[model samples]
Target chain A: MKLTKLLATGAVALGLATGAWAQDKTKVGFVYVGPVGDGGWTYEHDKGRQAVEKEFGDKVETVFVESVPEGPDAERVMTQMALDGADLIFTTSFGYMDPTINVAKKFPDVKFEHATGYKTAPNVSVYSARFYEGRAVQGHIAGKMTESNIVGYIGSYPIPEVVRGINSAFIHARKANPDVQFKIVWAYTWFDPAKEADAAKVLIEQGADVILQHTDSTAPQAAAQDAGNVITFGQASDMSEYKPKPRVSSIIDNWAPYYIARTQAVMDGTWESTSTWDGIREGMVEIGEITDAVPADVKEEAVALMNSIANGEYHPFTGPLKKQDGSDWLAEGETADDGTLAGMNFYVEGLEGEIPQ
Target chain B: MDLSAINPVLLVASLMVAATPILLAGIGELVVEKSGVLNLGVEGMMITGAICGFAVTVETGSPALGFVAAAVGGALLSLLFAVLTQVALANQVASGLALTLFGLGLSALMGQGYVGIKPPSTPKLDIPVLSDLPVVGRILFGHDLVLYLGIALVAAVWATLKYTRAGLILRAVGENHDAAHALGYKVIRIRTLAILFGGACAGLGGAYISLVRVPQWTEGMTAGVGWIALALVVFASWKPWRVLLGAYLFGGVTVVQLNLQAAGVAIPVEYLAMSPYLVTILVLVILSADKSRAPASLGRSFHAAH
Candidate 1:
């Protein structure tokens, strides 16, 4: 009887405290798949969270749990955050798609946002940056710079996101230099520095003078630096510390503006379930500075390509493409629809190796 | 498949560097187990060491001091495990798992500022004539000091375990801690010291990864390597030389599989990705036919009054 009385009082006190706080400020929570210090994907996401804090100073309270694993644990974390009076939650990473939706169902009034995922619920929204647009420019640079005609790519996973990047990069590279060949080594992970470095070394040893990676980490940049003449592009962030030599340029994911807009929408009661895919024009995916290592003409061409893509003058996957088996994909002047790009699995023409189920 | 593109000398050199970290951790755990304690906190100690080494190296611009600090950091973290299991008579398994969790969290906290900061590079030992001996020289002499130290430690461990009086006492303690206690040997003291040594070794292994291998600090950079080292100790049948051999075998498979992928081998990429673990399991299965034994009193908490 005493334990029950204490529990009842404790529950009442907690509810009253949270209810009072909720009236004044909205509580927002973020779940990151990697440490906020990862200097890549999670780091950029955390920066967006910081932007939210700066934008909504006294109107909102923000909290984040880092390095939360995907699957059941993610669902559990989301449930706990919702129970703790979080008005909105952002679960970053593709693996959190299902968990975000599941949690959204239980907390119908609470809003949920997921990054790099396709799933959505009545109370959940999905958002991803068009990283392939940036990959096209990197491919053009790699094609122009490769002396061996061999460019290496390090893939994190065989998911559509990575496959789209490969296809986009390959298409533009072949356009710039018909002799260019791509050798891809799949590390099957988002971030393992040793493995990433080893992949870079093996590519260098195999005569790939230009390297690209979808994996987060600057190990490949370091590897390219050690190999002297080899060139690399930073993935997901401006790993510009190795500039003027190895890391000549990079694709930076800019999520701050989107994060602020969504937070504002939630506060204004205008938030709705929607899937958004924004590119360079909206300032979601940014291309980092092209260092002097890139030739003047190649740099100019890359800049022009970026401007064209941003201004809706060019489509990376516009026709004249074939599947690896040499079957027609997009005819000349024909562009790939978002449906095919969203579920991209096959390699384009001239690319070898399976996607790995 | 373009096999000619793969350089034999570079592959051997790269594998050596790849195997050193695990080999160091495995040999250390072998000693800890030999002293009748199973410290499952190798992963935690390793990440702690990685961050400590990276931070110290970045701050002091000295890779050598960074390694020393890594050893100290690892040993200090393992001391927590020692206190819980040795002094408090806590459950070894539970305490060890807790230690790993604590270490990972603590290291991440410590590593928050050190991320993306490159550490001082450890220079390779240039041994004049030997380093210029064509392919052999490049494979043997063109490596940093840690690679050589790892091989030397393996040889030293084998010699000590096989020939020294201290090794006999350690073996005795592991076989029957109560009997060794009855014989007036300080069983707790010996085990504690062994645990600290094991921690230092694991730390060095982690430092090797951060300071030389990848040469930068990243969260969870050890990335299940500690677990691999633990499995390696068991796979080696608690023998130091076998641990070295196993590390090399696993490392060789990892390097070769990457090479195969780069060469565009017809095999599926998934199969190639899992080849290292698969080959390790295959070798372990083949070796287990000999019925290797573990130390009898391993993982048992020693209480003098009991």
Candidate 2:
């Protein structure tokens, strides 16, 4: 009899709690692919999440589940948040695309935003930043600084986003220094530090003085620092802690403005399914200060390149570009379309070796 | 493929550094499994040690003291396992899995402050002229004291297991705990000590990564390496020297595959990614197929009343 009474009281309290959540607070949920303390990719996404909280104050309630593996498990996290009265959910990782769509179908009223992904539904939105624009600036500096003419690239995965960075960097690198070469190593992980350090060491041993990574860790920067001469560019967040040498420059991914705007839309009932891909011009992709490690002229050129891309005066993918097989991709003075760049699988011309299938 | 770009001497040097953590963890697990206590919490213990070591190093500004604290922290956590499995006679597997979950959460909470903060480097073994020789210097002397300690730990474990009376007694207990108990050997006390030792070694391995290898602290930075050490012990047929070799070979495959990819080698990326596990297992599988096998009383709980 006592157990039955306790159960009835517990049910009433739970109902009232959830009832309070629905009546006033706009609950926003975030699912991260790596730990929020990763100091790189997930770190920036978490900063965006925090911005949402700061923007709305008591009007919004924010919750997040970090280190979520990108598979069927992601669907479970999204489903739980939706059932718990999450008005909007942001699944932050390319791998979460399908899982986001699957969970959105079940909770049609729950708006879902998936980052760095392509799939979308009436209830699901897809968003990404043009990080290749920053990569172009990195390549320009790398080509100018590398005494060995060999720049190493540590790629997280062979997805379009990563492959696109490789191509964009290589294209500008070749233009900067005709003899420049790129050595690409795919790590197959987004967040393993030991593996990333090993990959950086391997590239350094093979004579790459300039290292640009798409992986989310400071291990590569540490490895480069230990090597004493190598220079690296930070990914996702400004890893300025290693500044003045190893981390000469960085690509800072700013998602706060977008996250704030989207959450505001949910509160105002103006939320709609959308595909948003913003970059330098939109302040989604930013270039961190080019440090003294880069030559003055090279740094100046990099800044100029960044400003041109930001102001619509130049496109990083401006043509006379060719595919890896020597076939023409873009005609002279022609720029790449968003569709081709989004699904980029083949490397641009003059890039050695094949993109691993 | 530009094979010329692949420098073999430096590869040998980096592979050893890469293999050190697993080597330490594998040798420790070998001793634990030899005592018939299967603690599957090596992963949990390792990450805990990583944070403990990192946090201590950052606070005290001494990597050496940090390593000691890590070992103590890991052993302290493992003492919980020792109590549950030895004193209470609880299920070893379930307790170990629970310990891992507990350790991961515990370490994350502990390491909240240490994230992105680089630990003070472990002081190098400056062997004067020996460290100046070109290829030989790099492969031999281009490392800190902890790395040499990892290799030395393997050798000491091998000598102790083969030559010491304590090893024989530990083996006897593992083979038949009931008979050993009748012979006046305290099975519970022996396992608790062995569990502590296993926990300490796992801690040292975790510290090697956090202080020397990656040399930075991040939540979950151990990254499934403890589980790799667990498999390595079984693959080495519970032998110490073979654990050292197996770790190097495993570590070598990973470093080499990355080099191959960077050199633009034409091998499929998927195959190269899986090659480390395949090569390690292929060689160790052949070695483990002989008469040498697991202990007679492995994973079976021992209670005097039973």
Candidate 3:
């Protein structure tokens, strides 16, 4: 009877230990450039993380740290997260690319995904939306709606991302209306509402009735709303509350689907490093609800354009184009490939200002 | 020269506005250091000001009132350090460093809501005739009220130190607090007041960053401007006028590099970007070459009982 009791106790202990070991949660971490509650970049990213929680339930766990500047501090935080047993990490900023790559090298088992960056390692993947596609649609709308024919562009930096957006917008705008002109202001930062608003004011004073921004803030929309009769697009997220006053249409960054898919892959053990520059076709970049403020005919045209792009039946960057220097850019029936678009440094022919060195 | 691309006049104006926060912080620090008080917590004081100014502005909807609140908030934070160093007779350097760390964490917590929201427009002053002049007109005359205030502060501080009896008493206390105490000048009180004033000025500078310069409360928006201000006090050798020159010079370097980039100058962005910091360090090395001019009792702790 004593031997039987000892054997039964031993079996119970072994079963409990195995069960506890199997219950280990897979930890996922995120780093953001802005606070999670900002209702913008970091907010959208956090929403995606929450979506993962909803989808996975108890299969995984999520954690985040906000307002981390892109520098040596980024590396430290990333390493800390990895040390804390994060199975996967997402760094959301272009400046975080190298740091993410560096950390990925140290912990080869950890999966890293860097946003808006090109560099990739064996354990790292790069992901960014086709933001310029949305710019093209915004450009078309601005080109049609503006009575002033002067469009103001609030650019964060002269980096290729912003510059490409400017060119893409200009290309489509000038295509629609030859007389349309753009006044550009370089705020040289991703987020600064004061500078962004000031730049918008300068452009408005200079007679721009339609404004677009590459910066990450609603200041441009606020400034446009305050000015009255001015129109601006929602950047990074749908800002419908300010509709008609400022936001008419927005380029919504839908990360939930991607987040869910990625997390599911991690659960299924099918996760592989890949660079994804998804757009309307992949449903990563979405054009938000077009408001009634836009003319019915223009709205119809915009929707059709969006549908066609989403169906891959039309490309915003279709060419018969030339560079600002009058060099042949694309031949007839040619569209700009991703390779050419990735390193776009020159402006389109109609753009008046020179690219900043 | 692409005049339209790189408008020299507008460039100068922007530089003055951009430099305002640093200028305000730097000048205030210079005064504090001149009084023989070493408050390296300008960054902390500035961030405290930023959060306070932003919060008040959001609550009251009046930026002007917010700025006043910011100054008070900054001075109050400084009082914490003053007590530690003055009453407790702690090490000023360590206490100042602690203040900075505390300020940064506190501001981050306080600035949670004001992150993406835009503040009210900062009023700009347009001098009638001067603003209309070619070249120099736009550079000097057309700016916000703070630019002129910054300039006036340098002159006011210089005159006070050079010509006023109050300045002499303050200087005497700074030079030898032991002697000043023996002479019945109330050394601790004067130093405390000077420290408070410095804290207020630094706070205003910080508020300028959130309220005017960046026009948004960002985490670490001051971006080492406070440290640069601390360095400037040394670079200026505790002189008010030189502080002005240093602020403008550093401001000019920043403006010029930006202008060069806008003008499509062939230099790499990273090199031009790093120039301001590099030059500031070089200037400090040159200025401190004659170490005889430095404050006699800088970073010294005072104990009345001892």
- Every model's DockQ: 0.62, 0.70, 0.12
The residue-by-residue lDDT of candidate 1 on A52-162, one tens digit each, is 999899998898998788789999999988988888899988889999988899999999999988887889999999999999999999999999999999998889999
Docking class of 3: incorrect
Give the DockQ (C-alpha) for candidate 2. Answer: 0.70
Candidate 1 backbone collisions, by pair: none
lDDT of each: 0.89, 0.90, 0.79
The DockQ of predicted model 1 stands at 0.62
lDDT of 1: 0.89
Write candidate 1's Cα lDDT for B1-306 as tens digits. Answer: 778889988899898988988998898899999898998999999989888888988999999999999999999999999999999888899888988899889999999887766677898989999999999899988899888888898898888878999888999999999999999999989999999999999999999988888877888778789999999888878888888888998888888988888888888999999999888868876786798789999999888986
lDDT of 2 by residue, A1-357 (tens): 686699999987996697577658999999998888888999999999999989889898998998898999999999988888899999999999889988988998999999999999999899999999999999999998999999999998889999999999998999899999999999999999899999999999999999999999888998898888999999999998889889999999999999999999988899888999999999999999889988899999999999999999999899899898989999999999999989999999888887778
Which sections of candidate 2 miss by over 4 Å?
A: A1-23
> What's model 3's overall lDDT?
0.79
Best by lDDT: 2
Interface RMSD of each: 1.4, 1.0, 5.3
- After superposition on all C-alphas, the RMSD of every candidate to the true structure, in Å, is 3.0, 2.8, 7.7
For candidate 2, write residues B191-274 as lDDT tens digits: 899999889888988888888888788777888899999999988989898899899999999999999999999999889999
